[model samples]
Target: MNAIVIGAGVVGLAVARALAMAGHDTFILDGEPAFGTWTSARNSEVIHAGIYYPQGSLKARLCVVGKEMLYAYCATRDVPHSNCKKLIFAADASQSPKLDGILASALGAGVTDLVRLSANEVRKIEPALRCEEALLSPSTGIIDSHAFMMALLADAEAHGAQLVCNTKVTRVVRKNGQWAIYVDGSAEVAATADIVINSGGLAAQNIAANTEGLDPATVPPLYLARGVYFSYSSVLPFHHLIYPIPEQGGLGTHLTLDLAGRSRFGPDVEWISEIDYRVDPSRHAKFVAGARQIWADIDPTKLRPAFAGIRPKLSGPGEPAADFAVLGPADHGSPGLVCLFGIESPGLTASLAIADLVLHKVATD
Candidate 1:
């Protein structure tokens, strides 16, 4: 069977690898010049330990399962990663209750390495942090995202999968039991495949809606939420990722360190009408305030505007968060077609697991 995966992000590359491993001729098409130019590259790069998501949700299940797979894969592939744990703490006594709730939720989701710590215990691990209570996630870590993506792409190519860049898939249509994919960019081309998987991160909804025979009602609305990061010029005092209590539409502005031990804070959620990656210099005040809640010594003057990334959200501001939508034949009555919607935060962590799920759905359907 021949398969085409639209969007060459981390998830798309993983799916292509899975398809090639299944003895299918797989091709990955992306509009970007390279893989992971969007949401996949622009993130905190934290490998979540399946915490904070509701029990039995896709995010929870995939994250727990994927984190394990990722650590093993990184070790085996020589990918640059750190098993540096994370500290999700309550900045004040009033937030202590929320820490307990997060613990319960993480336990319910099968993350067993979480340890609740007192103020003194938190200070012992991260002496610079000031929190009333905290949850130490031993499994949470960070990875060099570009290296991981390159490894995935290399492995997929080794298995006979091919990646095509600078090509935008204009539309897809079902023609006589196969998918006709029309693409434009470097050259106008039309290709046919036995299966088509829409893994387009930000433009997933647009891809689904453009399909000739698909139902418009099945395509959920897309909300673009821009989150900006601010880099700290000074050295970081803590070795672990620090997260405050999650806020509406996003995790609160927190500190994350790259492999070089440089610290940065941010990703404050801002809802927007269209795609924009520009970081507003004015948002530094809010980031500074949020960071100080975790560590009091943070200097506001040292914080500077950095890059930003947009999340594809199904729900809007002040609304409930939505789960990963892996629509298959059961939802749209279309054979050999799968559409992924609203895959945001843990999408990078869940890439391998999601690829497994997509392969299972394709095989079963």
Candidate 2:
């Protein structure tokens, strides 16, 4: 079987790897000069333990299964990662009930390793933290996402998959029981394959809209939610990833340490009209305020503007969070094609599971 996967992000690479491993000739295309340079690299790199998502949703299911798969893959493949754990805390006694609700939700999502901690227990583990209560997720961790993607690409190439960077798939037309892919405004078809998976991250909807046989109504509107990161100038006193309660459009401003132990606070949700990666210097004060909720002794002067990332969301502000949309031929009545949309948070962690699902859907549908 010949397969072509659009978008060279982590999810796309994973799908390509799976298809190639299944003995299909696979090719990966990306508009950027390299793969995994967009949303895949811009996230907190935290391996979520399936908490905070609605039970039975794709986010919950894929994240739970994918977290385990990711950990195992990293261990065997020598990919740099850490199961350093995470703490979701409540600032005051009045907010402690939220911890119960979170714990219940996590349990429903098959995350049973969460340990409820009182303020004193929290102080014992993290002396710098000032919280009324907390939930310690032992399964939560971080990964070197770039290394992970590089490994996936290597495996795919070893299995006869090819990656073409800067090759933007402008349109896909189903003809003669196959997909004719056009790239870079070329009038002629760039390639043809029996299976075409639209895994474009932020540009996914646009690619679907351009596909000839796909239904226009099936394409969901893309909402860009920009989250800015502010890196701490020095190492912090926290050993675990520190998070507050969930916020609208994202998890609260949390502190995540990279592999080198450099800490950063960030990703405050801001809805935007256009795609922009600029970190607003004025947001420093807002980040400081959010940081103080977790650490009272954090020095504001040490916080500096680091970077920002935009999430290609399906739902808008004030609306309920949307699930990951993996629309195959069964959903859209378009055979031999699968379009993935609203794949944002926990995407890096769930990349492998998502690839498995995509392969199964294309095969069965």
Candidate 3:
């Protein structure tokens, strides 16, 4: 089968590798001059342990499976990553029961390595932390996402997949028996393929709306949520990733360290109406307050505006979070068309698993 995958993000690259490895001629297209420049580059880069997501959800199932696959892939490919572990904590007694709920959710998702810790117990390992209770996730860690994407692209190219950058897929129309893709709104068809997968991270909804033969009702509304990070200039006190209780749209402003051992506090979520990457320096006070909840000794002077990334969310404010939406040909009545939406957070970790799932769908359909 000849396949065309739109958007060369991590998930798209992984899917291309799978299609190519399965003896299909694969082509990857992206709007940017380089791949993995959007959501793939702007992230916390943490390898989640499948916690917090509701049990039986795609995020939970794939995250647990993808975490292990990613670790193994990193090892074999010599990609830089670490099992530095993580600590999800409750700042006071009122929030302690959330720890048990998180544990139950993790267990349901097949993550059984979480260990409950008391404040004193946590102090023994991380004296700088000031939490009432916490759950230690030994399997959680961080990864060099850029390197990981590079590896996937290398494997795809090695397996005869071609990648074309700076070509934005404007519309997809159903021809006689195949899909005709147009780029940059040009009247001429850019290419045609037997199978087409829409993995356009941020631009997915727009692409689906522009798809001629697809049902407009199947296109879910796109919600944008921007998250900003602040880098800590001084040395980090804690060894493991420190997280607070989950919030409505995201995990709270927690602390995470890069592979170089440098510290950063981040991802304060703010709902937005448009795409913007500008970091607000005024948010430094909010970051300081959030950081003080975990480590009281955090110096405000060291905190500086680092960067920001917007999430391509499906649900809006005050609504329950949505699961990963992988709409196949069977659901939308469009032959040989598969679309993925709301692939944020653990998408990097779940890249390989998502690819496998897409391949299985392609085979069965």
Candidate 2: C-alpha RMSD after superposition: 0.8
Candidate 2 per-residue lDDT, tens place, 1-365, comes to 99999999999999999999999999999999999999998989999999988999999999999999999999999999999999999988888898889999999998999999988999999999998889999999999999999999999999999999999999899899999999999999999999999999999999999999799999999999998999999889999999998876578899999999999998888899988998879888999999998888889999999988889999998899999999998899998899999999989999999999999998897
- 1 versus 3: better TM-score goes to: 3
Answer with 1 or 2, whichever has the higher TM-score: 2
TM-score, each model? 0.97, 0.99, 0.98
Tens digits of per-residue lDDT, candidate 3, 256-338, equal 99999989998988999999999999998999999998888889999999999988999999899988999898889899999
Please write out the lDDT profile of model 1 over residues 112-189, one tens digit for every residue: 899999999988889999878898999988999999999999998998999999989988988888998988732333
Looking at candidate 3, the ten consecutive residues that score lowest on lDDT are 245-254
lDDT measured at residue 201 in model 1 versus the true structure, 0 to 100: 91
Q: How does residue 183 of candidate 1 score in lDDT? A: 85
Model 3 misplaced stretches (Cα beyond 4 Å): none
C-alpha local distance difference test of each model: 0.90, 0.93, 0.93
Clashes by residue pair, model 3: none
User: Looking at candidate 1, what is the lDDT of residue 39?
Assistant: 92
Cα deviation in Å at residue 54, candidate 3?
Answer: 1.0
Per candidate, the number of residue pairs that clash is 0, 0, 0
The TM-score of predicted model 3 comes to: 0.98
RMSD for each of the candidates: 1.5, 0.8, 1.0
